[model samples]
Target: MDHTPLRIAIIGGGVSGLSLAYYLQKFGSEAARQIEITLFERKSSLGGNAETVWVDLGNRRLPGKPGTPYRRWADLGVNDVNLATSPHLRTLLAEIGELERLKPLENTASYFSRDGSVALTDDRELFRGASDPSHELSLADGGRLAVLIALLHRSAIDLVESRRITPRYTVDDFFDACAAAPAEMLSAAANALNVDIDWEDPALPERLERLRHTVYYPRISAMYFTDDRGPGGMPLQAPFEYYRLQEGGSPPDRRYFEHGVQHWLEALAAHITGPLKQGPRVEILRGIEVEARLSTQGVTLTERAPGERRWEADLLIMATHAEDALPLLTFGDGLSETQRELQHILGKVRYTRSFGVCHTSATRLPPNPNLWRTRNIEIRGREDTFHPYRIDYVVNRHQNDAETPCYDRAGLPQFFVSLVDDLNRIPRSEMLDRHASPPDAPASLAGAALGAAGYRDRLPAIESALEAKAWTLFKHNVLDAECLEAQAEIERYNQRTARRRYEGHRGVCPLLFAGGWTRGAGLQEQCLKQSAHLVALLLAAPERRLNPLRLAASGGQARQRHSQASGFAPLPASL
Candidate 1:
């Protein structure tokens, strides 16, 4: 047996890249020792979006006793994990030996209208009860809820059957089909889905192609069903029996770490490099950039630093965002026709940007304190379609501030993470010092206001500099879909070329793509699932070794047939 280590180079340290390394080391077994990994991350931090910041409450204590300023951690990006939709992530946590650290977070939410009126509120999660909470709903609100639920179920059912449905149909299209549905209800549901998908032109219904139903159904259905083979599990199979389970209510088991997600990332990296029964197999490099030169034989990775070091690998993993990964690959002469086409398909994937600002601001929430919930949707005005739904997440409440309860305690203000489409909507006082870059920075609304109000004088001695800043802005690469057909094409391309590379096809580079952007939008589960699949493929071919982990093969043939029926032509393999 050939006992040579399969050199693998990873280019991103985010969930996708980090998880891939973990799985390879965990599942590779005896063959694992025969695999060597070198991961490069440009950022000094490892977990890309899973960032946690420790905030000192100094004199601004919430629910705790007033002497010393309470110190607490805040998640600035990718906060909670829903076990129902994050089964893969759950498995990862278990493998890393941190499953016991999981804590439950309340995922309840209330939707508010432009005038601070309650449009809809669901407390199934908060109460943990089976009884419906709609008994007190007015006739009109009750009617709207009924219609919205029916529409979601109908879309899920049609998508599962995949018959008589347009492959390119979008959430907007599905909403428009129900013309009799009230406009206010439709708007409410759209905002509930997340945000105005059409960030550029919210006025145009035609441009609202945020995600195709083919993509959205599986995701939305997963959220509702939470189990295997639910409404969306087997779209082709009859799901009536599974659909009936909706009555039980798929309450999200929002999970988090008492410390932060960063702890998990560190634990995962440590476990991967920990005392392997055989020997050390993973090497992680931080604060470095890597560039790859692809060829039919293998991949050559070069460090983009002063030393100009280089290393050869059996395969290359571009486990970063599509935009960041594109420039890392040297695209000149060593590439094959298929390889170029793969890059083209990747380039077709699109991304949209949004901002998450963490601040101690109650102004972003509704005026009525009684309506404040774990997640509050503040609809400024329905007519203001360009940007709808300013989502203010009660960080303390959602993360269970009972230990440090921030609300109505000592008359102290609560901390919120408001998600906004436009950065300018946020007051300069509430944005992070580093993120207040010019061109995109919001107006200086509080320069004089803070000074006039003596905000600095109120800060504790140890917290003066940072506490003066009310917000820490986290810019997110929000996943938006222009055409998911590109994803289908890429999958087909990979399957068609998988065997060719194994057989030593002259111009094939053993390259695999994994990231939230590659499949749908940026979700933690998506990254884990994609990385797991790649690990399975890597351990199963060429060398013909088996790994303990197995990923269900994506039903590519069926999707291909649907793509053809929908008239999605394969992207030509041309320069």
Candidate 2:
């Protein structure tokens, strides 16, 4: 007797969706043999943001095959995923036999968010002018740093739990409360950099406006919006977990894959898209634009490609960012309870505009070794209303296989620069150019952009460049106080729907959400946890669905697998 199998539709073929598909095949293959899953991706390939491309060095011929040229591989999106920071991914990588492939990354000890600093008298700040070189950095003692963490963690937990009885809470509210001391410390630091920031504005709004840049800069970098040296988010916050703070300074324990991040993603893809004897028959559709419509019974996905106009699914998972996901849900009515709930939650998110280009030019590579190992060369840009935004290099960020040809071919390190819109404020499409130099830099800065590196004379013209336009950086703004109220409303609605399941209520929205943005921080670490959350929801729902914290608390199957390798977390990266 064959029973009807559950049909699931996944939107966006990035890591989150792919991980979901992998887990479904892993856990559901036995119970739900006939489970059907379909994944749609707008890009020609899977692994959103995890693109592994190669550069051709003037037609370097391959061995035996003279006509064939060698192409050096580079990562466009995520570079590394630490098993310690994200243990869940370690589990997945092990399950798919990608664990041993992880190798420690080079030390990015010295970093340059701004090339040179200005001289300053105060030594208790984060910086002094780059010229001084004497007062580069000063940090609070171990006890004070500990206090900062304790205060931040306690306040956040207290505020979030308050939602059980009170109204709403947003990330913004928490930051507004916690940002004062940190902002003051940063102000002294930035002043040392010779950057003009009005830290002493009289009005509250004006003061906060100036302060937001200093506070959010690290948070944004943590999301991979710009180049970063270490985990750059607050503890127990949305962007990332708050631990790993350093009193003086700490080097990031990074590990790059021999094959690259796509190596992990493709493994998950193979589980679903490949032929497996005891696997769910998951179908992957690429290069398709999707529009999803929600209804009481189920959802309809309108795909634009291969002449497929409409398709139905019992469940829909939107793995896209908030902005891209909004227009797809068109019920045509004014609004339904469920439709409005999804809209309000998703609409609150904001994003910063930025772009990236991979090129063969050495001009963008930093002359500093600290910047060299980090693969980040911070460049100060022409002034704009937006404060603290910067452009930086990201090449060699994921390098582990020291293939000399990649360096010898061009006689320079391969470099990619991630420039924020705050540098010029021009539209990304308009800003892209064939020249390696930025269009908005001043005439004086143009030739000197390399900044005493002396490589300006040696670097080649931007022979070929690939532009990633308006890549989603980080949340432009934190969650607002009103989000708590809205989330509460969603819970109440879902509760009602669940109670009416016997009355054909379709089992409380019947939608599951998973993505880098959905939980933790917007990085590979968070994506792994978010994926596990969805898997837990699918297999062990009602008891605990989409609750990553619960997953973290319950030392279940993942924990068992983890014990076999390392204790508690993966071994600390060999510094």
Candidate 3:
């Protein structure tokens, strides 16, 4: 066989694949001249899950045209873009000259039950205000809660450094410690903190047990924080603090996307597809089936276009979401045993169910507002529909216009509420029966119920309720579920084996594994760091790559310092 330039096919066109393409073009060596790269997308446009759509409001018109309607671009999913998850994304944006576009979302404010109505719950104020006596806490109980907080704070600090915390901690630890403390102190602490812990309630033990088994242990195992308190009421405590300490400060303003993230992504795609002229010249074959085979020559991919033409490539990189790409690969000569095994491991990578309702031409809410929380509503047979958690409205914080909120100015506010149920654990049949089908009609229920009850009624209640002029319901899976430990181990094994398999070909495959699932743990910062690691792997592969830990330990200077510090000096050249 002729030793020719390598042909590379990037299977998914999401951010990961695009990022890889951008860097491969920017950094590949002169030897990379032989590399031919093609990026394939099942969808006509790139961005994959990151796509956004503009909803037109017939009643609302822009200033110049009375009859012309206005539209607001609704980010169908991924409302928050964490700077900490992946520096590669940040670097990619910077290379494209769009890093300035990164922005931060407002600090979250929650609402909880108060006097049979909802009241504001600010985490900062809640922690700060705990010292005040009027808040009420018995000395003993207060001491215990204080001790718990201190331990948690310490644990959080440790997690920041090592990214590993023991999964053995349970709800019993929380309750037992409180129970063992002085009764008066516990009572006072409860009163002072205004925490609603009903010790005498018959369901207390069972609730605590449920929390231990389902929430606390699982979250600890997954290495992500849970709310445990606040409106969403997750089992783990101090979520925002965990992120702040680990990732180092809040992300760029999320609402700063002037034209929307899709705009930036499109701009990025245009630059890569048009100018950089990188590796494996991309031949986009829309509406074609991709087939992968282990040919005698090497791995060959045959793309069959609509009219029955075949296109082949030496190597294929699957960058689409695992769920979507898994099916595509399975259709061909079955995935290698190793790949099939990896898929099974990936199966344990759970996702949370999320439902978004978009309302257009509706009365906008105040900037950085908190929607009210209702009593833990149970969906009969569904354990606790509200059990794991839910989020009200992630309002646009970058909305600067006092009169017109959000950039598009469709005269409506963009609010996203998540249903937050464990997608993996739920039976498929039950999920289909419960949520697969859309409601008979799109009701303005969420906006009306959460808004009016939360006391945003500067306008008449009836008017506020009627403000929801038009709406749409979207159901998708949030990549925020816990991966069981057994599955994580399998993934680790598969990754090692896959890396070894590619090494025999002389050229290491540029295919990289990423996403929330592959991040070891699901913290946003972990995802960001993984992105950096992927970039490093791509840069140093088949030659100078450093071990994962050493790279992480030395930060970006691992290669430079490792050689010098190890005392394995290179011999001088003879004259």
Candidate 4:
């Protein structure tokens, strides 16, 4: 028997890349023992957007422990996970032995205007567009509740009936077909869904597919209604009660990491590369940016570090963001037609700069503490100047423990993470450690000075952390209209090429793309599912064909059952 191992190289240390490595090991069985994996990350840290910062509360102690340092951790990115909808993530947590660490939290939000008068707590109030305010405008004070609800019902009907319409159908098209959805409502929906565009503009409308994939459109539409079949294959009318459900469903079962998202990533990584891990030899290389070249021979990865190291692998997975992955691939007229097409499709994905600050700022929340929910969406200044994604997460509400240390006895020290589309909105005092800077601001790599330790090394000292909070800046990549179209094309291309490969035709490049960007919506679930599907394809037997639906359903539950039934028993003969 040939014991030669399959050499695999994965770029990007985010959920996509990590999950791919993990599944490969979990499913490869004894074949996994013959697989060698090299994971590369540009940042010194492993987790990409799953970053956490520890804050120090000077002189404050956790209830009884006075000797231990008083510190609490808060996620700077990827804070919440809807366990009900996230089977893949749930499986991962279980496999990595961290499933029990899931801390349930109430996922509620209060949307109000900057002047503190318009509090839209429920759908009726939201549709009304305002509560009681002197000059505040809620959701642009658009249509009455009855009118908006009618528009939604009509829009849902149109989407279901017109299922054959081009994927180019945009939110604008849906609104046009409905003819009664208020423009202000579109603006609000655009903001909530992170469209970041002038949604009302006839020239540029957010794609309906992108919005649907985002799955956060309950505020805007009953897209889920399009899924539930009624009698003769028509979409069932969604329950009117859906309006009460928060974006992505705010069930009592919603969970966040006990330590933070970074801890979860670390635990998964350890399970993948630790000594106890079975199968493949997994090596993680950090603080190294790699460029890839593909040929009939194999993949050659060249690092940007001082020595300019190089490595070889049979297959390369570009799990990095679309922006980061585009440049690494071989491009231009020199490439195959398929390669060129793939490059073009990948380049279509768009990204925008986003900023966030983790600070002890009560000012970022609603004026009335009573109005605070898990998430607070405040309209700063005025309606005309409203930012689409100015959300503040109350970290305290996410804590598993009922009581945590508070530095001051007068009032509990509240930790809030404010995500603003505009960096200028973050107060200067709150933007401590210079960890983040405005996009237009001259580039600062001060945080990068932490070397291989990454953000973990950049953590502020207890005293310093108490004085100046932690801030983070990351690329807010999105699968916009063009990106969604590109994804469809890419899927078609992959399917055709995979069929050809099954017939021993190596027509496409020896490369694969895995990331939330490759699919729809930059959510963790998208990343995990896409990566798992890619794994099934990469390791499938010659006669086997990829079934995304089957893989999605099986990967989580099958592996989970296998692990639980018998401790790390061999998987079934086939995935």
> What's the number of clashes in each of the models?
4, 12, 26, 1
Ten residues in sequence with the least summed lDDT for candidate 1:
566-575
The residue-by-residue lDDT of candidate 3 on 515-536, one tens digit each, is 4445433333344444444444
Pairs that collide in candidate 1 are 58-69, 160-235, 296-508, 401-405
- Which wins on TM-score, candidate 1 or candidate 2? 1
Candidate 4 local lDDT, 1-575, one digit each (tens): 44677788999898888988887777665342277889998877666766666655434445666644345567777776656546677767877788897876544455555576555442221221223432222222332222233334333433433456544544445544434434543444333333343336442323332222222232222111221111112112222112211122212145787666766776777788889777767888877888888775568898876888999887788887777786786632334775767768877765654556777667777787666655676533322322244467777765633333332331446677776555456666664342332232212222331222223333344345333446665554443356667777767765665455435555345677787667645567767878767766666543144344355566544533332222111111000
> On residues 243-317, what C-alpha lDDT tens digit does candidate 2 reach at each position?
221110122345676554555666666655766536677888766778887665677888765786788887777
Q: How well does model 3 score by local distance difference test?
A: 0.39
Best by lDDT: 4
What's the CA RMSD for each of the models?
A: 12.3, 11.6, 13.4, 11.8
| CA lDDT scores, all candidates in order | 0.52, 0.46, 0.39, 0.55
Candidate 2 whole-model C-alpha lDDT, 0 to 1? 0.46
Model 1 over residues 326-358: C-alpha lDDT tens digits? Answer: 688875466657557866777765443444556
The parts of candidate 4 lying over 4 Å away from their true place are 1-3, 30-33, 61-69, 122-166, 175-252, 331-334, 379-388, 400-411, 431-469, 497-502, 541-575
Better of 2 and 3 by lDDT: 2
Q: Model 1: residues >4 Å from true position, as ranges? A: 1-3, 29-33, 60-66, 128-151, 157-167, 180-251, 276-280, 332-336, 380-385, 388-390, 403-412, 422-424, 428-483, 541-548, 551-575
